[model samples]
Target: MIEANKLKMQLKCPMPKLDFDVITLGHGSGGVLTNKLLDSGVFKILSNPLLDERHDGALINLEGKTAFSTDSFLVSPIFFPGGNIGELAVNGTVNDLAMCGAIPKYLSLSFIIEEGLTMTEFWEILLSIKCACEKAGVTVVTGDTKVVEKGKGDKIFINTSGIGSIHPKANISSKRIKIGDKIIISGNIASHGMAIMSVREGLQFESEILSDTTNLNHTISALLDTFGDGIHLLTDPTRGGIATVFKEIAQHNGVGIDIFQSELPIDNQVSNACELLGLDPIYVANEGLFISFVDESIADDFLKTLRNDDNGTQANIIGTVVETHPKQVIMESVIGGKRVVNMLPGEQLPRIC
Candidate 1:
């Protein structure tokens, strides 16, 4: 009986040096396995001046006014139709800073790579990041990398932090918003969310859906040149889409908002997809788009200015701030009915950003 118990104990023990084939949850436990993955995969390739310090947060020194923002990308299927995790990470951070009326300048990238991921795919993602940085005219000054044991993580995840200089005279914030302000969207809604949904669910359509994940700093700068302080609020409708964004702005400024459904610019394909999936296009995410609130008198000029730009071809005034329903967001439907658009109680799509 004692000999039998000893043999069973030996059988139950796990091999310490066993090789992993995929990522496991243990890799994310911040243990030895997680550290090994980071040290072996990402850190070796991306060692740089800013990242070499290995600090909890990067030390960023800048001149004049500065804006800082950080974002993590966990969109599934990492590689989507029009963009991937790499491009999304860079653009996401850049746009965040720009939304604050900042001139995006530098970025720090950190990678959480899953074990068993192919080097070729990783290299491709890196290339995409390089291209995105070039397009945004920002330098990737620093970054960190870590790997997880097989089955311990998703395929790959990326986190990016960015710093930018706030453009002089570009005072934009929710606090500046007031009643009678006009709300303008840079372009169509729901494209990015639908694009990711199509890929994740293997849904094919007549026209290919592409993510609108591009840097908005240039278009924002153009608008700032013309509107400047008149632009009260500038925010990108990302994870929770337009409905959530309006609600946030309204709550922040202590005002009410009403949007006209008929005025929202949505692509036909996006509308069809949302209808089929029983998803509200208003609640879908948009990466390459933003909403601007400005004085009613400057609305026309703002619309014209946006329309003239390639990025704002579909720009339109979707709503207005009101003094009546403070801290509430309401929408006027196409059938002439008014309804409240509330914040999403829970996530509509997990890992969307």
Candidate 2:
């Protein structure tokens, strides 16, 4: 027993300088480390006020009042349970504009295909892109394609740029958040992350997991139609999950967030798989989920409107913004304790859309 305890203690010891000799899958995870790499390495050199704000979609003062955003998709296993990379690329860009309270109008697509890729697979991806555009009420205005030598590139890589019209009454920003505001989550967390992980790791459960990759503009429009300016900030929990979103909001707004553990909506299968893998569902990616910051007075009405929509059936008021702790996120445990919900230090799962 003494020897076993010593072995466990040694395993638990922290290694401060574990340099990555080669690129690992986690670099693409879109978690804390990914953000750190981008901010420190790239953003530092290209520093500009516009990019500094780091909003989902760049809000530019265009003559025609347009919102623009771009995103690249490289999710491995290209195809997954609910959707594939094509659908993800389209929806991801569309939703980025929607998060800025814009109506997505047009999109430009660029593809990088590897040599020797099957034409059938490429056709299927194109079909998915077409279907996604139809669902989002957008058009593929123009596109470009290229093929790279085999082994030099993945089977496929997609980059999409989108343009949209901003809502007149919509000026959502994390900086507008106040202490008494409410935090609302659109639906269950960690479904997409788990689905991708399951397929990649060959983990099987009784119930099949599905990715929550869908266009959320419809739901966002519905909520905006009802609440208008009551919504302070809107963000979809994508790569870094709910914890990262909360941290960003809190830091940007100069406020703290306090969430109730029991109020978080999590699907049973997702929770079970997360537990088994020693992961926290709160820090897992969720493609089709969003967090809304709004005033406390209209919290019920907002939640009611969201629940009435199909995409927001599991919507709930999970937490509140506070002035205490200034720029941190805290979660009240189900056992009547509190824990700091820090931003993930590194990636949990990679190539998860």
Candidate 3:
């Protein structure tokens, strides 16, 4: 019964309350209060050897070619069906480095908070950052915070900079793409953009469309393990989507791309949503997907590899590189004709990411 009595006493111990319930300008003033905020909140949640060093910048040892990337998250409706801004911020940067064939290592986060933002909400986002880092096997080694006037900002904006070590066998790059390289898309398109658009425009369809926001690090790693440098290129089609990305790739690599409409992976609900909104799925945003260009000889090997992955079950060989229409993307119509898929004349969906 002594153990039971000890458990009861431990439960009775009260937790300490935050000294200030809401953040103020002073928290960003680099004074005593700022240190308190970091110690009590950021440090408490993101406990790690590098972060606890308490230096102005983190000292990390990365050998070989290191990939570095940074991004800022201003996604509207910060909280979405499948994820919040915190997860998006971490995943986006992590995936950027992964696209470069890097093993993600560390991240630096900064928050731009609006005055009067709830303390609870701020802590919630921090906790999510921690969780995303854990899931991706990365760390937030350093950070900064600033408070803006209420009207000058949304509730909060997050910026993350990531560092990773590129594998020696990763020969993927826009310039490395060659003629006859096959293009493989990781999964269904337009879900993320449609998810945001549907909620923002108050359009209800047959079913709920959730954002496909996810980290592609593991999937890419699996491919690299199997195919190594045979994978010629990797890219996540974000703001401008696959069409725009394909056009840029064709232009940069001096190759023409032919995408087949019949091979495109479009969910029925997403296709219907696009039809109702006068949108095209190929030109919509996707957070959890990526495009891979592989040597035609091993294309099936890569496809089988991705198919074995849970997130890439819908992976499909969507197109091929051609020499005829150099620096252009041509889409073969379902009925058996071809059309030039130019870089979008203008933005189709703004701020969807």
Top model number, TM-score = 3
Residue pairs that clash (backbone atoms under 3 angstroms), model 3: none
TM-score of 2: 0.81
Give the clash total for candidate 1: 13
lDDT of 1 by residue, 49-160 (tens): 6656666766767899899999999888888877788888999999999999999998988778787676556655765776677678887777666777767778889999
Sort by TM-score, best first: what order?
3, 1, 2
Number of the candidate with higher lDDT, 1 or 2: 1
Q: Lowest summed lDDT over 10 consecutive residues: which window, candidate 1?
A: 1-10
Model 2 per-residue lDDT tens digits across residues 27-88:
33557644643443324432445545665544454455678999888888898887788888
Total backbone collisions, model 2: 0
| TM-score pick, better of 1 and 2 | 1
Residue 338, candidate 2: alpha-carbon lDDT:
98
